[model samples]
Target: MIGSLGLKLARFAVVLSVFALWEVLSRTGMVNPRLLPSASDTIAMLGQLLQRASVRSDLAVTASEVAVAFVLAVPCGALIGFAIAENRYFAEVAKPLLFFAFSIPKSIFLPMFILVFGVGFSQKVGFAFFSTIFIVIMSTTVAVDSVKTEYLTVARSYGATTAQTAFRVYLPSMLPVLLETVRISMIFNLTGVLLAEMYASRDGIGHQIATWGENFQMEQLLAGVLMIAIIAMTFNELVRWVETRCSHWRT
Candidate 1:
């Protein structure tokens, strides 16, 4: 724990040093400050924006889309994973398909999603779901597939039913592995939301950044970026807490 804390502190120190470098460079006119605002200017804009509750509302909307996509993906992905795990024949067929599906650039489908969902929350959620669900599916499938034959044999020796073996062994054993997939899915959703907001939505942090960027208000753009970083860090910390709590059952 001490080592982990020290590592995080070191990372934060590095980030601060980078910002200081940028600040010095901009203030010294090494680059035009208009194109790259100083950290102080950006921080001031962040402070001012935080004073308005509406900015929080914009964040809430994007967060809501993220939550919705995650909820929709988790059960479906888990079920898909379970089906694939139960059959090697299907896994051989579907694994490549999943890889191809994941590799498809989602922006290519945005037009169809926007047309179907009418540039609304549903479309954004769909985009987020597309971006995240495959990761969850593939990871969970691999985790379940790799369960030891010995464990299954032991459960069968105990006269355990299929459901009992699954609940008591497979699912529990896969939790740690799935947690990593969840973390990756969350990052994917974050990127998807940013893209959706930038291209389609009128009321998200991405939209705000685009609007401000067009007006040459670098400070506001920086403020939006800072808010995104803060939200991502907070959500990631929550996920870490949940992971630690879930794994504590092992101890």
Candidate 2:
């Protein structure tokens, strides 16, 4: 508990130090206010942005794209992961192909997505789904392979069927890894959605940020960034808490 508290305090201190430096830089004109707004101004503008209906709509657009992409990726990723993990020869062939594809940055395909889907939410969801699915598949396959053979043997001795053994033994053991993959994919999913919006979109959080930047609305731009940070931090904590809860049965 004390260690956790100390870590929290350290994180808080770092954030405060950064904001303090930002405030000083803006106030002293060391940083151009036109390009980098004061921390206070950004905070104030963030509150205003939250209160605006148009901004709320943009947030909703981004949120919906993320939700659709995440929903599509999870089951598909798990299926792919299980398939590869269950077959060594197939895994040897497919794993390299999957990794090779994953190594290519999602940006490389943004133009293709835009060309295929045009500048709208479909492209955003598609981009996010493709970008995030690989993480889930890679993590799940590794986790499945790492499951203890002893656990499966014990289940078999107890008369557990193959399905029961997998669900009751293997999956429980791999839960932490699966949740960690979700946490990681959540971040990348958002990045893909935002990149889509920034590249071309009629509306969304990313489009709003880009609009602010183009307009030289530095304070609003920073505020938009802060909003993204808040969203990411919220989901990160939520996933981490669930991961911690699931881990309690492990050790």
Candidate 3:
């Protein structure tokens, strides 16, 4: 209890120090106030932006893009991961290919996505899926592959079929890692969607931020950025809470 309190206090101090330093820098002209608005100005703008229905609508659009990307990625990733994990020959052949593909910056595909999808929400979803799907697939494969041989052997000794062993043994063992994968995937999903929006989109929070930036509306831009950070952090915290709840049942 004491340690947790101390940690929380330390985090608070760090945040406070950062804001204080930011304000001082802005006031002292060490940093360009036009580009890096003080914390107070940013917070005020954030408050005003939050009250706007249009901002809420943009927020919803970004959220939907992330949701769609996650839904598309998870099952496909799990299937691919399962296939690679279950077969040693396939794993040896496909793992390197997948890793190489992941190494390729997914943003490079954004232009093609925009060309194909035409600067719409579909392009954003596609970009996000392209960016995040590989991580999910790789994490899922690693998690399933790491399951103990003894556990599978025991299941087999009890006459468990492949499907039974996979669902009853492997799935349970991989749950924690799967949840972690989900958390990570959401973060990337948000980032990718935002990048897509910023790159070339007519709507969404990222577009708003881009518009604000182009106009030199530093407070508005920072507010949009902060809102995104808040949304991502909120999602991460929720996933972490779920993880904590399932911790006892994971292994």
Which numbered prediction scores highest in TM-score against the true structure?
A: 2
lDDT of 3 by residue, 1-251 (tens): 56998999999999899989999998888999987999889989999999999998998898898889889988788888888888899999999999999999888888999889898888998889888989998998989977899999999999999899879988888888888999999888888999999999888999999999999899899888888878889989999998878767655
User: What TM-score, over all chains together, does every model reach?
Assistant: 0.90, 0.96, 0.93
List the pairs of residues colliding in candidate 2. Answer: none
Minimum summed lDDT over a 10-residue window in model 2 is located at 31-40
lDDT of 2 at 71: 93
lDDT values of the candidates? 0.85, 0.92, 0.89
lDDT tens readout by residue for model 2, 1-251: 56998999999999999999999999999988887889999999999999999999999999999999999988899889989998999899999998898898878899999899998989999999988899889988988987989988899899999889878998898999888988998998999999999989999999999999999888899999999999999999999999999988766
Candidate 2 error regions (>4 Å): 1-3, 249-251
Stretches of candidate 1 exceeding 4 Å from the true structure: 1-9, 244-251
**Residue-wise C-alpha lDDT for candidate 1, range 133-189, written one tens digit per residue:** 888889888889767889999999999998899899887787877787788788888
lDDT of 1 at 162: 85
TM-score: the better of candidates 1 and 2? 2
Sum up the clashes in candidate 3: 0
Between prediction 1 and prediction 2, the one with superior lDDT is 2
